[model samples]
Target: MNEFSDKLLQWFDHSGRHDLPWQQQQTPYRVWVSEIMLQQTQVKTVIPYYQRFMERFPDLATLAQAEQEDVLAHWSGLGYYARGRNLHKAAQIIQQQHHGVFPTEFDEVVALPGIGRSTAGAILSMALKQRFVILDGNVKRVLSRFLAVAGWPGNKRIENHLWQVAEDFTPHERFDDYTQAIMDLGATLCTRSKPNCQACPVQANCMAFKLNRVKEFPFSKPKKVKPIKQAKLLMLINNQQQVWLEQRPQKGIWGGLWSLPQFETDEALVAALNPSVKTHSEAVSSLVKWKAFRHTFSHYHLDIEPVKLVQEAPADWQGQWHTFTQAESLGLPAPVKLLLSQLESEYVKNG
Candidate 1:
């Protein structure tokens, strides 16, 4: 092994995380799932989700056979709905095209939905002991700081440079250990905030450390104000105490998940509730208004204002009514779940 890999392996023997759920099995399917979950999410948050997911869909065949709604239900509050959608689609492809086996070829793996070059590299290296180089967020941070690579790593030029650096350091032997070690080093000592540089094994040659610019390396993305969008969610409840829900479109925000009926403004929502606009006119009354809040995504913020309406029977509403308990079991967004939980609590108290 080269000096870098040698030192990293030595440190990993003592400090690296060896007990992650995916590491115990190290199958391509398990590693692939864990890697996808780890994308833009922290390890602590991923552990339970990984365990629960594995229990629900143990293998490629099982996942491929599952309904998209059930699959999204498993990933309900995890966020990034597109990842869940892509993961389901990829499983079907693997089952039908690859005969239910995870693809082994690099190109084949990369072509799978949601599996990018880095994610494919990670899966291959860990599961098959391939010597593919990886450049996930943690790896990028570790490398960018170690080499003091200037410019945000998101920049194509900077990312490509880092990829080359990754190739240079990757050793032929013990690559799996090296892969996990580098990722561990970043996740632990070389963290995003208040990095534990003193304990880092590769600190001797880390350019940022030597230059006293550790904080400056792995430059942040250029800042732009995230656009704010507003919407109203109608929580129409009937005497049976079931709230009306509509399935979001197959694409876009909260896609494929069940959510409250949404409109651009209160006027639109009011018009929809009017008896004249109904397929069947039913008596309705305004109930208590819930506190409004905002759900922020990576590129934008959705300001959600929820209005609760009670009706004798919601014959006019176009969607189905689900009790709060039933709605909890469906694939609802995180904020939507919170709102429903609050409503459930109120219902129980009122009873």
Candidate 2:
């Protein structure tokens, strides 16, 4: 092993995390699920979710056989719904194409949906003890600071350079431990903000640390103004306290989840309810507009105006009516869950 690997391993022998849930069993399916869930999410937040998911779908065959709604329900409140959708799709593909076995070949693993180059490498190295290089966000941050890589890691050229650097640092033996060690170092010591440079094993060799510019190395992405969009969410309720819900189209935000009916404007919402009322004016006057809130996405901010309509839904309505308890069991977006909880609390306090 080189100096980098040697020191990192030495530090990892005592300080690295050894008891992560995924680290215990060390199966390809477990590692793949953990890797996918870890993307853009923190370790602490992922632990309970990971444990719950594993308990529900313990093996490749089990996950492959699960329904999309079931898979998505288990993934509720874990933002980035596309990850859950892609994971389910990939499992079904593996069941049919690979006969319910996790592929060992790098090409086949990376070809799976939501399994990018770094994720594939991580799964292979950690679970299969293969000598594959990983360039995940944590690895990228560590390498960027160590080598003082100049550009944002998102840039194609910068990413290629980091990949080459990662390839060079990968040790021939103890590939699994080495992979975990490097990731631990980044997650624990070399964090995005307020990095603990003193405890770092390779601090002496880190160019950014030596130059007192550690935070400057992994440059931030170019900023662009996120556009704000507006929507009116209609929470139509019946005398029985059942709320109307519809499944979102399977290709957009909150895809495949049950959600309140949304309209671009109040007029559009009124029009939808007009058929049940004597006049459009009567429907508009009946809407009780509650507090509006903002839910921000990566590319835009959605300003939501929740309007309550406490009338029985028309029999011809496209969606079904469900009590709050039933809705909680279905896959729901974070905001929808919050609104349901609020409504439940209000009903309890008032009654």
Full-model lDDT for every candidate: 0.89, 0.91
Error of 2 at 69 (Å): 0.8
lDDT of 2 by residue, 1-351 (tens): 889999999999999999999999899999999999999899999999999999999998888889888999999999999999999999999999998889999999999999999999999999988889898999999999999999999999999999999998989988789999999998999999989999999999999999999979799998889999999988888889899999999999999999999999887888777654545776677688889999999999999988888887666777889998899888999998888888878888998
Predicted candidate 1 versus true structure: per-residue lDDT over 1-351, tens digit per residue: 788889999999999999999998779999999999999789999899889999999999999999999999989889998998999999999999999999999999999999999999999999988889899999999999999999999999999999999998989998999999999998999999989999999999999999999999899999999999998887778889898888899988999999988888766666666646653212223434567789999989999988888764346555688988889789998988888888888889999
Least lDDT summed over 10 consecutive residues: which range in candidate 1? 279-288
Clashing pairs in 1: none
**Would you estimate the TM-scores of all the predictions?**
0.95, 0.97
Q: List the residue pairs that clash in candidate 2.
A: none
Q: Local error of candidate 2 at 170, Å?
A: 1.0
Residue 193 alpha-carbon offset, candidate 2, angstroms: 1.1
Top-scoring candidate (TM-score): 2
